[model samples]
Target chain A: MEPKVKSAMQMKIQVRKKKTIVAKDRLFSFLFILPSILAIAIFVYGFIGWTGYVSLSNWNSQIPDFSFAGLKNYVSLFHDFRFQADLRNTAVFMILFIVLVLGMGLMIAVFLDQKIKFENLFRNIFFFPMALSFIVTGVVWQWILNPSTGVNLLMKKVGIEPMWYTSVKVIPGVEWGKIQVGIPIAVIAVVIAAVWQMTGFSVAMYLAGLRAIPDEVREAARMDGATEFQIFRKIIFPLLLPITISVIIIMAHISLKIFDLIYAMTGPGANFVTDVPGVYMFETTFRGNYYASGAAIAIIMLLSVAIFIVPYLLSNRKGES
Target chain B: MKKKWFAFLSFMLALSLLLVGCNSDRASKSGGNGTRLDIFSWWTGAGEEDGLKALIKLFKEKHPEVKVENAAVAGGAGTNAKAVLASRMQGNDPPATFQVHGGAELNDGWVAAGKMKPLNELYKEEGWNDKFPKELIDLVSKDGNIYSVPVNIHRGNVLWYNKRIFKDNGLKAPKTFAEFFKVADQLKAKGITPLALGDKEPWTATQLFEDVLLGTLGPDDYKKLWTKEVSFDDPKVKEAVKTFKKMLGYINKDHSSRNWQDASQLVGKGEAAMNIMGDWAKGYFVNDLKLKVNKDFGWVTTPGTQHSFMVITDTFGLPKGIKNEDDVMKFLSLLGSVEGQDTFNPLKGSIPARIDADPSKYDAYGRLTMKEFKKARITPSLAHGSAAPEGVVTKVNNAVNIFVTQQNEAQFIDALKTAASELK
Candidate 1:
C-alpha cells in the first residue's frame, strides 16, 4: 500500500511536470510567431490606422495638418469629376476583367484537360506571362496597341482601324450628373492587356481544380449513357464552382486596386477614360500632394477590395468548420 | 530544453532589434564627417545627363573635398522624382539640393509648405542681384525672399518643325493663328499630319492650351489669370479654349498613344509638320536623333507669343533640415555662376537663367533665345508647373484632357473656373 501510494505520488509529479512542459511549448511557439505578429501589427495595421486618420484630417498640402475635418475630404471626392470617372472606370474594369479571366481560364483549363499531345508545352506557354510583372506587361501592350502602328498595321489592311487606347468613345453614353456613365472603349484595351497577363493565374487554379476531380465522376456519368457535353455541364462545371468563386474573388481584388499597368500604359487616358482609383490615388498623393484626398481614394479602394474578400473569407471559414 | 528554446528566442529578438536599429541609424546618418552632397534631379536623359555630369565635374574641380551623389531619378519631366523628393522632404530627410521649377513649384510647393529656407543671403553674397534677370529672380522669390537659384531656362513656347517638311510643302513658320491655319490646311491637304501632338500624359495637351492662352491673352493678362486678376470665365479665356480646340483638329489621330518624343519623331521623319514643345526638344534632336539644328529643324515662337518668353527654369534650393548646409550653398553658388551656366546650358539645349552668361558658348538656337530673353516679357509657364500651384495644375490638366476628347467648350470653361478656385 505504501509502494502504491509512492507510485501514485510519482504519477502526480509526472502529470504536473507534463503540464509545465505543455505550457512551456505553448510559450515557445508563441515566442516563435511573436516577431511576425509584432511586425505586421506595427507596419501593416499601424500604417493603415495612420492612413485612416490622415484621410479624416485636413492634410491637403505638404505640411501635415492633422486637424480633424470629419468626412469633408470624402464628400469633395464624391463630387469631384476625376474621382467620379475613376470610380466608374474601376467598376467597369473589375467586372470585365474578372468575367474575361474566369471565362478564358475555364475554357483553357478544359482544353488542356482533354489529355492532348504537347500538354506540357501548352501549359508552359499559357503560364509564361504570369512570370512577368504588370509594368512590363503594360509597356509591351502599349507598343502592341499603339494606334499608328503594331496591331493597327494589320487592322488597317482589313480596312478596320480601331484607335485602340487612343479612342475616347464611351458606348451607351448617358450623361450622369457630373461624369458620363458608360463603358469607356479605351478601357477595353487595358482590359485586354490585363486579361492576357492574369488569365494564366486563373488557368493555373482551374487546372489544379480540374485535376483534383475524381475520374469516377466522369466515368459514372458515361456509364449512365450521358453525353460528354452533358457530363461536363451537369457534373464537371458544378464541381468547379468553388474554384470559379475563388478566381472571381482573387481577380476582383486585383482589378480593383490595379495601378502600375494603367499608369505605365495609358496614364489616366483622354478624359480619364483608362483611369482607376489606384492611378488617381498615386498621382493625387505624390504628384499633387493632396494627401487627404489621396488617402480617401486609398480607403475607397480598400473598401472595394474588401467587398469581395470579406464574404469569401467568411465562407471559407464556414466551409472548413 | 525549454530554457534553451527561450534563450534562442531572446537571441533572435535581440538580433532583429539590432538589425533594425542599424538600418534606422544608417538612414539618418548623412553629411557627417564625409560631407556628401546628394544632388537630385530628373535629368537622366542623354543630353540632360551629360549636362548634369559636366556641371558636377565642374563643381568637383572647385570643391575637391566634397563627394557629390548624382541622385537623378529617371522619369520624364520629374514625374517620379517629385514624388520621391516629396516623401523625402516630408520624412525630414531631404537631399543636399534638388531640382525644382523656379516659380510656383518652388514658391507654392516647397516654400509655402515651410520646407525650404530663404536663399536671400546666398544671392546677396554671390552678387546675384545683377546676375539673373529681375523678372527671373522674382519667380524664385516669395514675399521678398529668394528661395532658390535658377540654373537653366527652357523657352516653353517654341514651335519646332522639320525644315525639310516645311521646305517640301512651301510653308514658312506661322507667326499668327491665321497663318498657322493656312499652313495646317496645306499640310492636311498633302495627307501629312499638321501637328504631331502626343497627349498620352495630358500635360502635353495642357502645354498646347497654355501656349494658345499666352497667344490669345498676351503675356500681361495671361499672368493675371493665376492671380485672379483675370478670371477663367473671361471672353479672352474662352477664345483661347476655342483656338486650342481648332488646333486639336489638326493633330495626328494617334496622338493619344504617343508621348512627346514619339510626336517629335513624326516631325523628324517628315510625316508630321510641327511640334510645339519646349527647347528641350532641340536637345532631343541634336543629341538623340543626331539631327542638325538649324538645317534639319527650324524653330519659331508659338503663334502670337513672339515677345512673350514662357519661362520654365530648373532651380536648386536648400531644404530646411538637410545636414550639409555649407556644402549645399557651395553647390548653389556654382549653379548660379556664369561658367557653371555656360558649361551646363549648351549641352542641355537650354539658355542660361543668368543674363550675364556667355553667348559664344551656346548653339545658334540657344544664342537666339539668349538674345530674346533680354528683351522678351518673361512669363511663367502653367503647363510646366510655374504659373500655378500643383493642385490647380492637376485640375487644369484633367480639364484640358477632357476638353481634348469631348471638345465641349462650355464644360471646359466651367472646369477651368472650378480649377482656378484652388489658386487662392
Candidate 2:
C-alpha cells in the first residue's frame, strides 16, 4: 500500500511536469508574436483610425483642426465634379481593364499550353512586362502613345490617326449632372497601358491552373467526340474559373487604387479624363493640402477596393471552413 | 525551461533592436552641433540647377564651417518638392531653409498654418526693406509680418515667340487680344501652328487665363478678384474668359498630351510660332535647347498688361522647428543680398527680386526684365500659387481643364464663381 501511494505521487509529479512544459511552450510562442501584434496594431490600425477621424473633421487646411465637421467632406466630395468624373473613370477603367486582361491572359495561356514552337520564349515575352513597374511602363507607353510623336506618327502614315489619350471625347455623350456619364476616350489609353503591364500576372495564374489540370480530362473530352474548341470551353475554361475569379479580384483592387500609371502617363488628362480617385486623393492631399477632403477621398477608395475584396475574403473563409 | 526563457528574451531583444535601428537613423542625422543646413528646392532643371549649385558654392565660400546640403527635388515647378516639404513640415522635421512661392503659397500655406517664423527681423536687419519692391514685400507678408525673402522673380506674363517665325512671316509681336487673333490667323493661313500650348498638367492653361485676366481687369482689379472686391461674375471677367477661349482655339491640336517644356520645344523647333509661358521658358530655350535669347526667341508681355508684371517669385524662409536657425538666417540673408541674387538669377534666367541687383551680371533678357520689374506693377500669379491658396488654384485649374474640353463659357464662369468662395 505504501509502494502504491508512492507510485501515485510519482505519476502526479510527472503529469504536473508535462502541464508546466506545455504552458511554458505556449507562453514562449505568444511572446514571440507579441511585438508583431503590437507593431501592426499601432502602425496600421492606429493610423487607419486616425485617418478615419481626420476624414470626419474640419482639418481641410494645413493646420490640424480636429473640430467635428460630420460628413461635410464626404458630402462635398460626392457633389464635387472632379470626384464624380473620377468615379466614372474608375468604373469604366476597372471593367475594361479586367475584361481585356482576362481575355488576353486566357488566350495567351492556352496558346502556351499547346506544343507550339518557342513556347517558353512566348511565355517569357508575355510575362516580361510583369517585371517592369507601373511607373516605367507608364513612361514608356506615354512616349509610344504620345498623340503627335508616337503611334500617331505611324497611324498618320496610314491616313488615320486617332487622338489617343489627347482626345477628351466621352463615348455616348450622356451628360449626367456635372460629369459626362460615359467612358472617356483618354481612359482607354491608360487602360491599354495598364493591361499591357498586368496581363502577364493573369497569364501566369491561368497557365498554372492549366498545367495543374490532368491530361485525362482533355483526353476524356476528346473521347466524347468533342472538338478542340468545345473541349476547351467544356473542360479547360470551366476549370479556370477559380483562377478567373482570383484574377478579377486582384485586378479589381489594382485598378481601383491605380495612381502611379495614370499619374505618370497622362496626369488627370485634360479635364480629368484619365483621373482616378487615387490620383485625385494624392493631388488633393499632398499638392493642395486639403487633408480632410483627401482623407474622405481615401476612405471612398478604401470602400471601393473593399467592395470587391470583402465578399471575396468572406467567400474564401467560408470555403475554408 | 531555460530554452523557453532564452527564446522569449531573444525575441524581446530583437524587437527592441529593430526599434532602435529605426530611431538611430534620424538620431544620427540630427545629432550634430547645427553644422548641417538643408536648402530644399525644386531647382534640379538645367538653368535652375546651375543656379542652385552656384548659390550653394557661394554659401560654402562664405561659411566654410556650415555645411549646405542641396536638397533639390527634381520636378517641374516644385510639384514634387512642395509635397515633400508638406509631409516633413507635418512631421515637424523641416529642413533649415526651403523654397516656396512668395505670396499665397508662403503666407496662406505655411505662415497661416503657424509653421513659419516671421522674417520681419531678418528683413530689417538685412535692410531688405527697400531692396525688394513694396508690392513684392506685401506678397510674402501676412498680418504685417514678412515671412520670406524672395530670391529670384520669374515673370509669369511673358509671351515667347520664335524670332525666325516672326521674321519669316514679316509679323510684329502682338500687343493686344485683337492683334493676337490677327497674328494667329495670319500664322494659321501660312500653315504654321499658332500659340503652342501643352495643358497636360492644366496649370499652363490656368496661367494663360490669369494673363488674360490681367489684360482685361488690369492689375489692381485683378488683385481685387483674390480679395473678393471684384466678383468673378464681372463683365470684365467674362470678357477675359472670352478672350482666353479665343486664344485657346489657336493652340496645338496635341496640346493635351504635352507639358510646358514640350510646348516650349515646339516654339524652339519653329513648329509653332508662339508660346505664352513664364520667363523660365527662357531658361529652357537658352540652357536646354541652346537657343539665343534675342536671335532665336523674342519675348513680349502677354497681348496686354505690358505695364503689369505677373511675378512668380521663388522665396526661402525659416520653418518654425528647424535646428539650424542661425545657419538658415545666414542663408536667407545671402538669398536676399544683391550679389547672391545677381549670381543666381543670371544662371536661372529669372530677374533678381532685389531692385538693387547689378544689371551688368544679367543677360540681355534678364536686363530687360529687371528694368521692367522696377517700373511695372507687380501682380501675383494664380496658377503658380501666389494670388490664391493652392486649393483655389487647383479648383481653377480643374475649371480651366473642363472649359478646355467643353468650351462652355457659362459653366466655366459658374465654376470660377464657386471657386472664388475659397479665396476667403
Candidate 3:
C-alpha cells in the first residue's frame, strides 16, 4: 500500500512539470510575435490614423492646422467638376482595362497550350512587360503615342493618322454638373499602355488555372459527343470563375490608385480628360496646398476599392463554407 | 559545374555592385569638416543644370571647405519640387536654401507660413539694397524686411519669330493686336501655323492670357488687379479675354499634345512662324538646336505689351531650422554677388538680376534685353507665380484649361472673378 501511494505521487509531479513547460513555451512564443505586432501597429496603422486625422483637419499649407473641419472637404470634392470627371474616367479605364487584359490573356494562354513552337520563349515575351514599373511604361508609351512624332508619324505613311492621346472627344448624352459622364476617347491610349503592362499577370494566372483542370475531364466531354468549342465552354470557362474574380479584384485596386502613369503619360489632358483621383489628389495636396481636399480624395479612393472587395470577400467566404 | 560557376560569378558581381553603391552614398553624405549645405531647385534640364553646375564650380573656388548638395527635383515646372519642399518644411527638415520665385510666391506663400527668415541684414551687408531694382526688392520683401536674393530674370513677354520665315514672306513683326491678326491671316494663308502654342500643360495658355491682360489693363491697372483695387469683372478684363480668345484660333492644330519644348521645336523647324515664350527659348535655339541667334530667330515684346516688362525671377531664400547658417549665408551672398550673377545668367539664357552685370559677356539678344531692362517698366508675371497667390493661380490654371477646350467666354470671365474673390 505504501508503494502504490508513492507511484501516484510521482505521476502527479510529472503532470505539474508538463503544465509549467507548456506555459513557458506559450510565453516565449508571445515574446517572438510582440515586435512584429508593435511594428505593424506603430508604422502601418499609426500612419493611416494620422492620415485620417489630417483629412478631418484644416491643414492646407506648410503648417499643420489640425482644427476639426468635419466633412466639409468631402462635400466640396463631390461638388468639384474635376473630381466628377475623374470618377467617370476611372470607371471607364478600369472596365476597359480588365476586359482587354482578360480577353488577351486567355487567348494567349490557349494559343500556347496548342504546343506551339518556342512556347517558353513566347511565354517569357508575354510576361516581360509585367517586370517593368508603371512609370517606365508610361514614359515609353508617351513617346509612342506622341500625336505628331511617334506611331502617328508611321501611321501617316499608311494613310491612317489617328490621334492617340490628343483627342478630347467623349461619348454623348450623359452629364454631371459641368463634367461629361461618359468615357473619354483619349483614355483608350492610356488603357492600352496599362493593359499591356498588366496582361502578363492574368496570363500566368489563367494558364495555371487551365493546367489545373484534368485532361480526363476534357476526354470525358469529348467522349460524350461534345465538340472542342463545346468542351471548352462547358468544361473549362466555368472552372476559371474564381481566378477571374481574383484577377478582377487585383486589377480594380491598381486602377483605383493609379498616379505615376497618368501623371507621366497624359497630364490632366485637354479639359481634364485623362485626370484620375490620384493625379487630382497629388495636385490638390502638393501643388494647390489643399491638404484636406487631397485627403478627401485619398479616403474616396480607399472606399471605392473597398466597395469592390468587401462584397467579393463575403461571397467567397460563403462559398467556402 | 558550368551552372554553379555562372551562379557564383553573378553573386560576386552583385555583391561588388552593392558595395560600390554604398561606398558612393557614404562619400556623398560626408565632407568639409562634416558640414553639408543642401541647395534645392528645379533646374534639371540641360542648359539650366549646366548653368547651376557652373555656379557651383565658382562657389567651390571661393569656399572649398563647404560641401554642397544640388537637390534638383524636376517635374511639371517645379510642381513636384514644391510638393517635396512643402513636406520637408513641415517635417522640420528644411534644406539650407531652396528656390522660390520672387514676389507673392515667396512672401505670401513661405514667409507667411513662418518658414523663411527675414534677409534685411544680408541685403544691407552685401549692399544689395542699391544693386537690384526697387520694384524687385519690394517684391522680395515683406513690410520692409527683405526675405530672398534674386539670381536671374527671365522676361516673360518675349515673342520669338523665325527670321527666315519673316524675311522670305516679306513680313515684319507686329506691334498691335490688329496688326498681329493681319500677320496671322497672311501666315495662315501661306499654310504656316501662325502661333506655336503647346497647351498640353495648360500654363502655356495662361501665360498668353497674362500677356493679353497686361496689354489691356496697362501695368498700373494690372497691379491693381492683384491688390484687389480692380475686379476681374471690369470691362477692360472682358476685352482682354476676347483678345486672348482671338489669339487662340491661330495656334497649331496639334497644340494639345505638345509641351512648351515641342512647340519651340515648331518654330525651329520653320513649321510655324512665331512662338511667344520666355527668352529661355533663345538658349534652346542657339545651344540645343544649333540655330544662329539673330540669323535664324528674332525676338520682340508680345504685341501691345512692349512698354511693360513682364519679369519671372528665380530667387533663393533661407528656410528656418538650417543647421549650417554661416555656410548658407555665404552661399546666398555669392548668389547675390555680381560675379555669381555674371557666371550664371549668361549660360542660363536669362539676364542677371543685378544692373551692374557686364553686357559684353552676354549674347546679342541678352545685351538687347539688358539695355531694355534699364528703362522698361517692370511688370510681374501672373502665371509664373509673381503677381498672384498660389490659390488664385491654381484656380486660374484650371479655368484657363477648361476655357481652352470649351471656348466659353462668359464662363471664363466668371471663373476669373471667382478666383479673384477667393484670393481676397
**DockQ pick, better of 1 and 3:** 1
What is candidate 2's CAPRI-style docking category based on DockQ?
medium
The lDDT per prediction is 0.90, 0.90, 0.87
Give residue B408's lDDT in candidate 1 (0 to 100). 97
> For residues B92-128, could you state the per-residue lDDT of candidate 2 as single tens digits?
8898889999899988889988998998898888888
By descending TM-score, how would the candidates be arranged? Answer: 1, 2, 3
lDDT of 1 by residue, B253-341 (tens): 88888899999998888889999998888888887788998899999999999999999999999999877899999999989999999
Q: Just chain B of model 1: what TM-score?
A: 0.96
How many pairs collide in each candidate, listed in order? 0, 0, 0
lDDT over C-alpha atoms for residue B43 of model 1: 96
- Point out where model 2 deviates above 4 Å: A1-22, B1-4, B29-32
- How would you encode candidate 3's per-residue C-alpha lDDT over B202-252 as one tens digit per residue? 889899999989888898898889889999989999999999999989998
lDDT string, candidate 2, A1-321, tens digits: 999999999999999999998997797778778888999999988988888999999987777899999999999999988899999999999999999999999988888988799988998999999999999999999999997777878999999978756888899769998888988988988899999989999999999999999999888888889998898888888899988999999999999999999988999988788898999998888777789999999998988899999999999999999
Number of the top candidate by TM-score?
1
